[model samples]
Target: MVNKLEVAWTLATVALIAGVAAYSTVLLYHLDALPAHPDEYVDVIGHQWFWEFCYPQNVSKVGCFNATYDPTTGATTGGHLWAAPGSVVQVNITAADVIHSFNIPGLGIRLDAIPGRVNSIAFTVPQVAAGTSFLIQCTEFCGTYHGTMRADLVVT
Candidate 1:
């Protein structure tokens, strides 16, 4: 029963399984790794249908406001995210009313904004050209106007 065909197929399956296991181990390691001390710590508080951002690391004046962005100029006019290129930005995420999710598509950040508890993720600002912008949205369905709950991360 152990013909050449059978031996070849068994070897191929073993190789495939080993490859997947190696790849998963690498991914898990990076996911759990901690970044250097964050350059800025931003508190992200989610609401029923909106997002509130506060810059607690500011020295002179701590900025806090509703998230707003300018699409044409890639500028954040309100409490939206702004960080220097190559800076580590750590976000403490939580929700006031219900469950939510804070996600940035470009940065591979997706963490739950749970009630009464805080979840955090650290992302380094990429070396983007001036005026580059990234869109962040809630992946969890909260309520009406959820589609409109969005913000922009401007690298300036």
Candidate 2:
């Protein structure tokens, strides 16, 4: 009983609405899929110009070092934090100087490191993945050379 043009228009409108709804749903899902905690490390302190990594097993041994903007040419003197794939790693992050952020793009991990308190994040790496490398940058506006705050991370 309905005209062909009207039926086609109604169908087109329904399709458009469904498409938009689907797209928005996906966007929200991905946003929530982002990592909320740090990997297998804990008590990461971010100072004015350096970072101190503390191992869970050895609490007394605090490893202090500088982060490099360039991973390949940067200094490798400090100890590295390594995590295997399909593992849930928890990291307790804090800052001594200003607010900083721990971020790994490939691993989808990003969390803020605030002073006076510790921030925590948990992340699980995918299996047989190509391992991602990331650097920690000062998300907050700190002192001079704030842009240089960085580190390297390998997810295996």
Query: Residues 39-108, candidate 1, lDDT per residue (tens digit)?
Result: 8888999887767888887774377778754446654456667777999988999999989999999988
- List model 2 lDDT by residue over 1-156, tens digit each: 889999999999999999999999999887555365454565677776555667765445455444445446664335444456777667778888788776666667777888898777666656755555455455656677665566555555
Candidate 1 segments exceeding 4 Å error: 1-29, 68-77
Clashing pairs in 1: none
Worst 10 residues of 2 by lDDT: 59-68
Q: What is the lDDT of residue 31 in candidate 1?
A: 84
State each model's CA lDDT, in order: 0.83, 0.65
* TM-scores vs. true structure, each candidate: 0.75, 0.59
